[model samples]
Target: MPFTFEPLPIAVAALTFLLAGFVKGVIGLGLPTVAMGLLGAVMEPAQAASLLIVPSLVTNVWQLATGPRFGVLARRLWLMMVGVVVGTLAGTGFMQGGHAEQAATALGVALVAYAVLGLTAIRFAVPPRAEWWLGPVIGVVTGLVTAATGVFVIPAVPYLGALGLTKDELIQALGLSFTVSTVALAAALAGGGTFEAGTAGASALALAPALIGMTMGGWVRGRVSEQMFRRCFFLGLLALGAHLASRTLI
Candidate 1:
């Protein structure tokens, strides 16, 4: 309710955005993963998701608009988009009920499972059996996490990567995924009582950091080695998930 752009909050916002963007830039994903927890400490979970949405959109748009694989990304486009839209809506709707800590605990657990899967090289697929249904399942998980903790980029990335898609397809899939998620979140907020004008404005303010982070991340993308960055990213996820889970039990 208060509008005091105090120096600390501002700085924190900028750092969070910058760090998130950097992660995305280097690995082609994980901005939300990097920033969600930090943002949660300073702002409500819903507000944090709203704030990052614009910046995330901008970053993805840039990739889709200027990258070299738009045409390739066009094929199979509808399916992935639809999935993200559904999942994001489901996730956000769950958050509307105000389950911050529980969501965090659940998300941390899921991330730990996913990370372990990633490490163990487990193979899960949408099943020749109606991937359409599978899409929303991913969407709901992502959307809930996005609403709860501001990090919905996890499952989508690994799923896409596993398909052995090219770089363009990967980027484009993420772009579409975020787009659908963003729209769904807005609609969900409108339906719920949490959609406030001031909070939206604050979210907009936070977008700057996200954009800046993406910009910096883009530059870093070329320079950073993927193998190293990924190793670090997974390790970071493990650490963060462990911390989150520990907090829940303690």
Candidate 2:
């Protein structure tokens, strides 16, 4: 089926993608979750997810390329990557028959949960005993959501953040996640026959807007204070969660 482009929706999508990528560029994560959650109200979840893969890859790669601790990030996250792969598979399978709205609702809840953790200072420190399981859990959750809806990074963020990684490490982890999940999702879409040439071309064309957003966000990063950004980030996540929940529930 040919994708009939209405100018309004495409313009809206491009703008939203730009804002979402900007946030990701500045903060190191939240692009897919924010973008897909918001976009799902207007487009099919699969399409939204597919549309983001290219832009997400670009920003994430740039972030990772600048990281100084690739060796440490790789060692630390090797196990977690396993979990992400599994989660991606499960999510993909689940999405094959699942409702997009349900996934959006779930994504909203997950973001709210993270925001709450940030607000309340609640920490789930991975113990040595449970450390072995953390990777798989992240992987499974990420995979399930990635496959089913394309917005699975929110849950993984707090856990990764808790690793006490420096800003650079965090950037590396986000990059790795974007690369792995993007590839997995693309493969899943191909296997499912949803990967279309025209869609891919459109996604590529839309990359410029996302890049522009990232550039603006980076410029703002130094001028703004960390505390200020944290305030806006959590509040934004909360608002986003509320919007998604309301959309899905109503």
Candidate 3:
């Protein structure tokens, strides 16, 4: 933590969080996704995840708390949240395993799937009646994926999109979900003995840059075309994902 890293890695983290935060600010998500994709390339998945916790948790909490419907959403989404926690706990040991290439490949596949979902702009409709069972199922799948790759946006994001929420509710729901996922991940990491104080410290310091980038991104959201921005962002993810996967396989 505390800038103890070599200048190169320190600078890399500062810039990476800054960029990742900006993307989240603009689009209302993607901080962890971007952070994991980029950082996982340079370090172990567990280490990258450790670096992700503070920044992602802080931002998502802010996102969750700022909403007016927090209590109502909590009541509604509790089942899904419970499932995420359970699934994450169930996946305790997979991420910290000794298989570097396997982890990298898993991360890559997650990225590609996420990128495709974003780029395709595919939308599914979930009737309000279905949330009780469907929500938990989706959460468990998302949690299992998160346990493997340290990314929680797969079926979760898609499932959320299908819920037919108003714009504000959707945003708040994302915050709550991501916040839960982050906490679950922290628990999983701790349980697996992969959590590190240094990584947490460095990730904490990353908060400043992430915040600054978010502010700037919020400002940009009004001026930039979000559709075009999303296309570009997902395209970048796709390329990065392919490289990570192919690099390991080859």
Off by over 4 Å in 1: 1-4, 90-93, 96-98, 120-133, 144-148, 193-195, 224-250
lDDT of 3 by residue, 139-180 (tens): 898788788778777667667767776656766888899999
Ten contiguous residues with the weakest lDDT in model 2: 89-98
Which is the leading candidate under TM-score?
2
TM-score against native, each model: 0.78, 0.88, 0.83
lDDT of 2 by residue, 179-250 (tens): 777777877776666657866776777689888988887777657676665665566677667766677666
Q: How well is each residue in 1-250 modelled by candidate 1, as lDDT tens digits?
A: 3323778767887888788776666556666655566766676656566556666666766666756666665555466666656665665556546667787777677667766765655655544455556555655566656655556555665566565564545556666666666676667665664556766676577677677767786776556565655565455566656655554576
Ranking by lDDT: 3, 2, 1
In model 1, pairs of residues that clash are 87-139, 87-140, 91-143, 91-144
Candidate 3 error regions (>4 Å): 1-4, 98-122, 222-250
Q: Clashing residue pairs, candidate 3?
A: none
